[model samples]
Target: MTGTRDRLAAQLEQWANRAHAARIAAPRRRPMPAGFLRGVSYAMTNRVDSSYASPRSFETLRALAKRDVNSISIMPFAFSRTASDPEIGFIHRNPSGETDEGTVLAVVHARQVGMSAMLKPQIWLGGGAFVGEIAMDREEDWKEWFADYRRFIVHNAVVAEAGQAELFCVGTELSKTEIRDGQWRSVIAAVRLATGAPLLYASNWAAGAVRVPFWDALDAIGVDFYDPLSANPLASDAELVLGARRAYAPLARLASTHRKPVVFTEAGYPPVRGAWLTPHEEPMDRPLDPEHAGRAIAAVFAALEREPGWKGVYWWKVFSDGQPAAPGSRDHNILGRAAERVVASAYARIARAVAGAPAR
Candidate 1:
């Protein structure tokens, strides 16, 4: 897991480095199309072959639509042994359970239900290493990692093109690699060559978003927001809402600076005690506390729903089979939790507002 200091350091470095101009080569920036996405992440199961194509997967999509969700982020994962292994790709014939064929099926199902899909290809690191720790000590190692990464991401873009995804996310939450402007430019270029779909590289919240130098090369700003709403685990409702407002205040400036919509590609608080204190991590010992989780997520919606330059948000995960990955160790799913009601209500309100008002 990424410690507070490590995450802060990455963010601060990006801020300081901004004074020095980054020389990146790419086509002129194009504006993203008009729309807001109310999305939920649908993850593929590693053990279940053709999981995304299952009837349960389609059922999950319908369930989300009932909650007023208008979009879904389809997740198919790649793997690496450790942070610096320089070997990044599929572990076998079907890496992370769902294949390109499965992803296409998921997208087709989502479209059948009148919801747009964002094909998001992400990396799942082994050895308990964080994606932010994916750095190499040698230049050759970095080169090797990027070489394989380019192929991996380009393959995903091809998948997105086939799926006809509403949006295509090149990568997710890989903070350490955000500084490789030249390498990333090449990767983005490859994806562009492969597909005409819109692209985004989802950044980790706050500092991670700041670290990504290639946001200008992409369509919209994608952020996986797990920023702490309060250091206090037992923060009051007002305190929680205040924390969320303060956390998102800077993003308004981020939107203006980039001249693009800021989308929360991932957002959620684990249904566990003190999740508000470190919204990103899933601690092993915290007891389940649906009340705390519901309040924390409601605060985020309360803060961002009316904020300017905010395009949309995708809740940070709901599995296809519709359950937590595990009870304690991986209980981030909102289904069967109090947070589900909060999300349903919030998304419903968003829908009403969008339907009744002028284009944002």
Candidate 2:
């Protein structure tokens, strides 16, 4: 046992030294501009082991490439029932743990497709409505939560560093705990020790993101923007675009104040009858309307095109299994839907426009 431990430690040290040497010898590449992250979020589930290695995974990658995006955010989740739980755990991954490994593989696959990768680790609160509700009343509970979260993040950070992922999200949508900026700053620092990749904290939305005082500690202002666009079930593209603009107004001011570019970590709308009325809701029983879904997506891109302060967007999701969406399914997954073409066109247009523009 002692011999095996020593051998493993030696291998890790050797790998780290090689990575450092390579980084030192490599020329500094020019930074991609603010609008560089033409991206999509790849969905991961607890049941799929070795998702990146699956045949379907590559198919999904091909589909994303058809969209002409230059980047992809690989989101893997770890769950905790509540803020008071003593530890954060991985509900996904067979045998209980492989987030770091899966993330590394996902990065490799994205790179193979000539797309930059973002390692986005998220928290899934079992049976909980949202992570925004996560909180603790006692100091001891806070300490316990941080202890577990730190270990989980640090583990993933090391993998991200080794995989050379272009970006790393320290945490996702933890609005309740995000106010503890000092502690989060420490968490960011710890992750930084293991990786040189640029980091961001993905807050729930601009409202929550603006309240996070520690944006100064990270690379970019990250928000999962799902602001209620329109309450009308059959809102037109112009109205939806206007609503998007309204949501972007305050976020633009916030980004200017901080002098940092803003990235939509996750932005999505379900293909449903009243999706425009409540952009964030996932009503399984709602009637499907691919046309409405496509319009909503186009509206988002139109607003982003007009908003210079925004940097990039990762559409909420494409599945890991690459399974075709059932005809008329009203779910949020965009795979194999008419919305996919809308996304592909938008991403292609943005990539071209950004490529031609001067860096900010």
lDDT of each: 0.81, 0.77
**Model 2 C-alpha lDDT per residue in residues 1-360, reported as the tens digit of each score:** 999999999999999999878743221222433446888888764445427655567667876776797788887667887655657886434522345666787788888888888888877777865877788888888888888889888778777777888888898878889778788988998887878788878888777777888988888888898887888877888899998888888789878888888889888888887566666677777787767777888888888775666778888777776665777667678777867878888877777766757654
Off by over 4 Å in 1: 1-34, 47-50, 91-96, 324-330, 356-359
TM-score computed on alpha carbons, candidate 2:
0.86
lDDT of 1: 0.81
Give a tens-digit lDDT track for model 1, residues 21-86: 765443333345345688888776654632787787888788888888888899877899898789
lDDT of 2 at 281: 77
For candidate 2, the lDDT comes to 0.77
The deviation in Å at residue 217 for candidate 2 is 0.7
Which candidate number maximizes lDDT? 1
The clash count for each model shown is: 0, 1
CA error at residue 338 for candidate 1, angstroms:
1.0
